[model samples]
Target chain A: EADIYQTPRYLVIGTGKKITLECSQTMGHDKMYWYQQDPGMELHLIHYSYGVNSTEKGDLSSESTVSRIRTEHFPLTLESARPSHTSQYLCASSEKTGIPSEAFFGQGTRLTVV
Target chain B: DQQVKQNSPSLSVQEGRISILNCDYTNSMFDYFLWYKKYPAEGPTFLISISSIKDKNEDGRFTVFLNKSAKHLSLHIVPSQPGDSAVYFCAANFQGGSEKLVFGKGTKLTVNP
Candidate 1:
């Protein structure tokens, strides 16, 4: 089935270690987004890409960075992980048109920095 | 500051009863709104949506009501089922090209059987 996918559904790493979270979609969507969320809390958008090679920061200021090399892949990298970075990272994709365009989301990556 | 707000952190409803979830927004620029349902260890799934121009929209047992003047919206689920227990988030987006969404703190709904 065509859907968004995120690797490393669960991760536990020491603080200050470098880590990368992978996200890919098979629907060929032009718009993709990354969001950070705490359990039972609001989701905060951290990064987004309009298309391949076009990336932008979202409302939240994040230490992590993202790249859109191909239309299907948008990966996020954290140079130095911290305990505060322990949260769920969600990846989503959507079409450009339509009112309230529905976004398809991946299962999400739960990171634990200790 | 939180642009969207879901005041009730959690709610409980008995099975076969009506369950109402409310959301309020401060930004009038938002013209489109959506509701998403999320379960443990899974990403949120789109439930329903409504445009600012429309007052209500319905799909199956899910219905979304929007009140532009009050900058408020609500989701009503009739005859709540145990499977309906999950966290529901309300999100809003503007009409411009960016289309970035502002989301509210989710409300956890528990349907007791």
Candidate 2:
């Protein structure tokens, strides 16, 4: 089983509130990613990190920011939450090696900005 | 334009029957494809994957067939079980280029027991 974990399985906060969603993985993976998904929509990549101090924006433009200071931890933060930010955030990781492999995902964090 | 597309919004199959889910991609540069299973309020789990070099890949009860010429792929599950009911997402990326994986809208599979 994958060792990835995401905190705050469900969160509901008022508008303009700042919040941080924590994600960590016990597995030593070089690549980490954050994806956002809405109901009946595809999972869109928002942020990704190749390694520590190497973060890149994903295909989808997001108002959130992420930091990869540790190999095992990647956190996503929203400075000012809005109702539009309500969605499920998923964290995933994969090893960087000879061949591309499948990524293991955490349970995910559901954020609701009321 | 969406790079990947899962035209079917949902699929239903009876128990012990075969269930097939299809996916199409617009980007020819994508050489790697993957299928992920997800439950409600949970993250997607890696189910199976296929490389462009090969046309077919099978693992246990699941099989993935890729057609490069048609830019289409399919996932087939035999003897479908109720536990297999979940949302399946098709993802693709350039294996030799970028690490970003593009995903489709996903197809919810319902296995009736």
Candidate 3:
């Protein structure tokens, strides 16, 4: 079956280290998004891409950046990781057609910066 | 400030009972609402949704109720089972130029067998 995938289900990196979280989808969706969530907390949208080479920041201000070189891949990168940046990063993809299109999410990457 | 709010952080219910999860939003412009279920170590999956125009929508054992006047929405799961124990999130979209969603803090449900 078609699904979205995220690598490094868990990551523990030192502060100030640069890290990249990988997200890929097999569904060929044009819209992809990245959300940050603390444990047992609300999800905050950080970055999103309408399509290849088109990326925009979401409602939340995030220090991380994202790139959409291919429709199936949307990766998030942090220049210098901080303890505050440690959280679960979830990747999702959805088709922009109807009014209530459902989003398919990846398992998510848990990052811990010490 | 949180635009969407799920006041209940956790809920417990007995098996075969009904589980009602509630969500409230401040943005009246939101036209679409969705409910998602998530398990540990896994991503959230779409459970059900309702539009602003619809008062209610049902799928199998899950039913979503939308109250536009109160700016509130709820998900009701009848005959709650042990497998139904997980975190549920409510999301709302303005449905304007950008369809970015505003999500509420999830509520964790535990169904005792």
Candidate 4:
């Protein structure tokens, strides 16, 4: 029932392959974030966008890049996938109007690079 | 350094029992706390939240207590059921900024029937 959506719920690809993970929300939220979580590990903010034409790298240093061309879409891309890139990528969106931006997440995309 | 920590990795409770999950934060700037529950293979869902102004916030069987002085918070689930079994995460954020949530590692709770 979550409005946010991530494509390729599960993906297994060879190393050196380029891939793009698509995330879209219908809620028209101005804030979008991409978090990376490994099994039994804390979630790490990889990238975020305040609004269209505004994007920044998060606390965690990641080789991935993200772009937000429209309010409803935020796509993360890896120019070259590696074994270290295997992890669960979660997409979330929140409204900026509140004091605390409580996020709504989409079912994560589990990626495995072999 | 981990600003937020959930010391216990896992907890087990019997059905209909009260389940208590603990969280601690080191950042004084965090003024709001939130709890999220996640099932396997799914994203975390917002369970409950508390503002800096209140010590306690309740939603049905779930209650969150924030002790700002101790930099700690706890989530209580009374009469816990099997369906309540999930990984719970504690998150915190401040007001002056963009309000990005800093999440703890999470504690996995198992409710035995």
Clashes of 2: 0
Interface RMSD of each: 1.5, 1.2, 1.4, 1.0
The CAPRI-style docking tier of model 4 reads medium
The second chain of candidate 4 has a TM-score of 0.98
DockQ of each: 0.70, 0.78, 0.74, 0.79
Worst 10 residues of 2 chain A by lDDT: A95-104
> Top model by DockQ, which number?
4
Q: Could you say which candidate leads in lDDT?
A: 2
* Best-to-worst lDDT order: 2, 4, 1, 3
**Model 4 deviation from native, Cα RMSD in Å:** 0.8
lDDT of 1 by residue, B53-100 (tens): 899999999999999999999999998999999999999998774787
Clashing pairs in 1: none
Give the distance in Å from residue B19's predicted Cα in candidate 4 to where it truly belongs. Answer: 0.5
Model 1: residues with Cα > 4 Å off, grouped in runs: none
lDDT-superior candidate, 2 or 3: 2
List runs of model 3 lying over 4 Å from the truth.
none
Q: Which candidate model has the greater TM-score, 1 or 3?
A: 1
Task: Estimate, for each residue in B75-108, the C-alpha lDDT of model 3 and write its tens digit.
Answer: 9999899999999999999676488877899999
* TM-score of every model versus the real structure: 0.97, 0.98, 0.97, 0.98
Q: State how far residue A93 of model 2 sits from its true place (Å).
A: 0.6
lDDT of 2 by residue, A8-113 (tens): 9999999999999999999999999999999999999999999999899998999999999999999999999999999999999999874667889999999999
Checking candidate 4 for backbone clashes, the offending pairs are: none
Residue pairs with colliding backbones in model 3 are none
